[model samples]
Target: MNAAPSVRAVIARHCRELLADPLLHGDPTLRDIAAQCHQPLRVLLVGNVSTGKSTLLNALIAGPLAATAFEETTSSVTWYHGPEPADPVLPDPGHRSVTTDFPLAGRVMLGDSPGLNTLSDNPRETLRMLGGSDLTGAAAAFVCVLVGGRVDQWAEGLEELAAFSAGPFDLVGNIVAVMAKVDEVDEAVEDIERRVSGDTTATFRFAAVNQLMAAAARTGAVDDRIVATLDRLRTLPVMHGRSAPAWDRLAEEVGTALPPGHLKALEQVVGAPAWLPALVAATAGMTTTGAVAEQFERMSRIRSLEAVLSDLADDSDLFTSTAAVLRLRRLAARLKPRPAALVRARLADLTATMHTSGLHRRAAARLVRHTDVGSGLTEHERAAAQALLRWPDAGADGGGTSDRATAAEVDVGAVLARWTAYEADPFRDSRSREVAALVIETARHRLRTTTRQEES
Candidate 1:
């Protein structure tokens, strides 16, 4: 027998069937939903005022789509659609949407939300978006920006937001807490990570990033012109200071190499002079724009953020499918009897199709991250399960030859035996047993695939 179809394929197939079905045909909302099934995963960026939400959004999409400044800039949620366009409106005027040529358009789209903890009513806008029940025009994942050393203060707020952002089933994969502008903080990223390591309520992964550095590197702000300015600054004796030189004194020293207009622009691009000496020292001999950008990118610590995004993107299908299913279920509730019945029928078929693969992946993620459920397993077992959960290209239709080659080496029988026994344990909690059964199905699929390959 053939392997089960991927969640996306199943959704797409059903979408076609729905459009052709007499009960659902000509429904604009259903058409919109059909189109969204094929679009990239929508990931929203949100945080407190001036926490670098816009800067991080620009960095992620490699464009200055959202306005950024010291004061509150973004007043509403703006969805940055990928190369292809989908529904722009979120059924609310507070939200705005635009399309761009971001290289990762097919894999992920991004949304920039107004900051929280502000004096103005901006916080309410963000809260309203998060509070909505309908997944229509909703983000599948979220990157919550927080300033360094403020994790403790915002821990409670973050937990509340996570409840709404992360889906009913997902725990860790759907949300990420990012400490933006970490360069300004005295403490290191590792220090912050260790600080929050014990916070059980914050289920998402943590990353500390210098949004300015990442934005500069990504937006090509660190070009040869900036390098020349840096080189000129290095020659001036006054530039080497324990504290940054005053703006007036530095302007005099700069003289003609950097005119007043150019100097101010440079200030905006590279940030304060306190970190320029470090940048000059880091890129000591680099001469080209690409070389400078490379050095700056390394200094940015942006790769850590990128790696997190890459892992999230690898599981895009899971998020997309989950969001789509939830969206359809909710849509069905309010529809008329005929269309509602058809939608319910289609949703059931979709669920039965993806039960083993898509649903099980979500269950495994939840089981691994749940403190109580995870603790029930041995350390070795937990680690193995996590490794398998994060294992790249575990989806049915997609992995490369290397992925299959690696899978061929796994002791599938041993994996099946262990998880199967865990599922059958009478002492296990009903919740744990249910999740374990899902995990066992995942293992069984792997065993079957491995067996077929070996037979071939």
Candidate 2:
């Protein structure tokens, strides 16, 4: 579906901001990058080793772009799309491959990545990359493919996938559990499917055991054992939602709860909260329909902004560049008037849209609307708007001094001096610290510029 006008406006605004960003100016392909941002669907295939992940990748692409083998073959995260065949293997610090191709369902771009359970020592890192990839901002759905096996194995895989899928970086209402290889199970798959579906509260899509068996028959790679496992998987209901709580409950019931070492391992690899075990249980017990719906909305907005920014940054022209800046400035102004409330309202509106149009379009629309500079005040409105922006937290009763006092006072000169000291050793400490210093300096510079402009 095409994005609404407001959505388009928000995206345009973000494009403007990204173009204005000093860091993104070097690249010449910004315009192409921006266009890619507008596509509707970007589905990703992610799962454990030998779980028909490659086969699924093949099925999605309908081609042999992803290498499939008996043994774990993926050495790094490989991205697959469509049409173009350019292999620019740039070094990505985050261990991700950026590709532009894949079928377009409206504006969506489908993505295929390396299997999560590969033999590499960096399997954890691979999963991290999958979870952290910019695809999170670009994706409309995540199809998690898995084979049916012993309950224990299935449980373990689900737990691992869940841990990787949590937090701010998660897909928005975009997760689907695909049970492949269902033809081998002796019993009816419906019973198992129903039971598991009840346990997870997330939507489960089932593929009959025969579907994979037929594909295997054609390929001759289908082992009887693997087929049987696939049958079991078919009979198994697709488990959805957070697996941590279910795993934790099972552990507590068996009195074999995760040990401290295992817990620490999960924390380090997954970066979940220390109380994640409890949180998972709580999330599982609570109805997640509302939460999932909300997440979809938030994701849509984020993606929309990403697309807009990509476009604005890539296509540099005088009007486009100026438009981008004005858009963000207007956004900042809107945010300043009742910053918290505006943010909340925008978030809510975006979330509401997710249930109908998937995530990306809604997100695109949100980005356009939120970022549109023209939506803010005209010149006549600037004085009042600027006053509100300057002291957003001011109380109705006494003025905004109390609120301003509560805000953290930034010392830009001190921050800049510290940054200069660290210039010789940039790798020391966290990059976030460095970025914070830069932001402080920028804010100070902007403030001074504004003061001077006002005086003149």
Top TM-score hit: 1
Per-residue lDDT for 1-456 in model 2, tens only?
122233323443344344455544422222222333343334456667766666555544334456666577655655554434343322143334445443332232344555675456746544543444322223334566666622334545454444444222121233445654433333345564565555552322223222222222223332333222222222223322233233344334324232333433222211222223322333342233344223322321223323322322221121122222222333334433544244344434433652212222222222222222113223322222222222212221122223222212434344345434543354544432333333334445546755897999
Error of 2 at 343 (Å): 13
Which sections of candidate 1 miss by over 4 Å? 1-3, 12-29, 85-97, 116-125, 133-137, 165-168, 232-263, 272-274, 333-342, 354-357, 362-405, 417-437, 444-456
* Alpha-carbon lDDT of model 2: 0.36
Report the Cα lDDT for residue 378, model 2.
Answer: 38
- Clash number for each model: 0, 33
Off by more than 4 A, model 2: 1-3, 6-9, 23-36, 84-108, 122-125, 130-140, 149-172, 203-456
The 10-residue segment with the lowest total lDDT in model 2: 312-321
